[model samples]
Target: MPYATSAAFAHDWPDTVRLVTVEGAPHTGAWNADAYAYAYAYAKELAAFLAQHT
Candidate 1:
């Protein structure tokens, strides 16, 4: 989905939604692209989100 759409969805549920944007990452790059520079940061953000929510 487009970033704007995602951002809007998150905005609709501000209390329970979190948005993480990787500036140069592709559609799935943040999670699946090993060579992408921000892959580790994506994982770290996901971990942090899980830790906070769980």
Candidate 2:
């Protein structure tokens, strides 16, 4: 599958949230990206914190 251009996204998400999925995304690639580290860590910390808090 191919990703649509910005124009397509603009049209699709104009009135609603248009979510895109990466087909065949490499497993754990996001975890390896430096930019994604914080997000992944935050998600883990939030999950654990919620479990303990609740």
Candidate 3:
């Protein structure tokens, strides 16, 4: 998000890592009102991802 430090880390993650990118999202996308508007759905997606990964 925003090509910031955290985003750079995610981008540099190894191939085995799971990386999810929310388009048009801000730094803290889940709480950003103007960005990631569908946060409830995003939460569900994140939960599913964690469930599968962990």
Q: Give one digit per residue, the lDDT tens place, for model 3 in 1-54.
A: 354665567668854444455567655664564444566666786898789889
Which 10-residue span in candidate 1 carries the lowest summed lDDT? Answer: 28-37
Cα error of candidate 1 at position 2, Å: 1.8
Full-model lDDT, candidate 1:
0.75
What's the C-alpha lDDT at position 16 in model 2?
43
Which candidate number would show the highest TM-score if scored against the true structure?
A: 1
Model 2 residue runs over 4 Å out of place are: 1-33
Candidate 1: residue 18 Cα off by (Å): 1.2
Model 2 steric clash pairs = none
How would the candidate models be sorted by TM-score, starting from the highest? Answer: 1, 3, 2
Per model, state how many residue pairs clash.
0, 0, 0
- The per-residue C-alpha lDDT of model 2 at residue 7 equals 41
Deviation from native of the Cα of residue 7 in model 1, angstroms: 0.9
**Candidate 3 residue pairs in backbone clash:** none
Better of 1 and 3 by TM-score: 1
Candidate 2 CA-lDDT value: 0.52
